[model samples]
Target: MHPKRKLTTVIAVGVAPLIAVSLPADTADAHGWVTSPASRQDQCFAGTVACGPIKWEPDAVEGPKGLKNCSGGNAQFADLDDDRKGWQVHDVNASETFTWQLTAQHSTSTWQYFVGNQKVAEFDQGGAQPPQFVKHRVNFGSVRGRQKVLAVWNIADTDNAFYACIDVNVRG
Candidate 1:
């Protein structure tokens, strides 16, 4: 090799390892999750219930825009899909406030709340970026007893949504 080419190759080899080391080992594109009324992943994060990887990343339960499962169709978070898991059930009033703790806010389309197959509440954002924290007043209406509420944050610019499931016992 030419003298100049040999020098260039030596510099490249020395700088490559430094560049790799300086880069982040793992990057988190986490969004958000229900903090109040304590969603399943939140329960796992808080150590209220024994869980898996979700304990470290409760804010990352995201999947495709339309999904009905608690784990957001993520197999790693499949623990959230297990109804038999000893999840803590909060006793809430007929009208309860659901709060979201956003790690990273995104341009949002809507926030939807559901019970079984029924949509109980929806707040449209119209492509606005949300704040670090968001809360919605959702009335249980006639829904009572032990129930699981699914909350979804639909992103306006992406074909994905952040999901969470909160277990509650609504007072009559």
Candidate 2:
């Protein structure tokens, strides 16, 4: 085989995986947020087994994510690109462990957040097509903070059980 041809093939083989990594996957947005809930009647329920909404003071506007520009539907959905209040959490705890839930009308889910709620992340789910409902999990990331940690849940979707209500749960 030609030297250049062999080298080209070798390079292609090595770079093929890298290219694939860069490319987004088809199921990428499979289980992600959607506009399923038309209004508050859709779903509602969060926190540690009916204690009330996850109470937490806005530590700070550390982030400006989600659909802050758009309007209608669930405020959480509207908060797609940015937070409605443009609030960012701050002074989160570094060491904490708990398993809470974010249940909705159509589906119910739970999460185990640890290392504080500093940079908490969520995992959303979409169905066969885009514009699916939200199914998020995770405590943001391992980014822990030390100070007056104030954790909270936006309660985007609603659960029929306790629809129109929101709550938060924490354990250590």
Top candidate, metric TM-score:
1
What is candidate 1's lDDT per residue for 1-172, written digit by digit as tens? 9999999999999999999999978876788999998999999999999899999999999999889989999999999999999999999999999999999899999999999999999999999999999999998899999999999999999999999999999999
Give the best candidate by lDDT: 1
lDDT of each: 0.95, 0.28
C-alpha RMSD values across all candidates: 3.3, 16.7
Which sections of candidate 2 miss by over 4 Å? 27-38, 41-172
Candidate 2, 1-172: lDDT as tens digits: 9999999999999999999999977742112111121111112111212211111211111122221122222343332222223232222233333222222222423221222333354333221221222332334234433322222223234321111111122222
Deviating ranges (above 4 Å) for candidate 1 = 1-26
lDDT of 1 at 4: 100
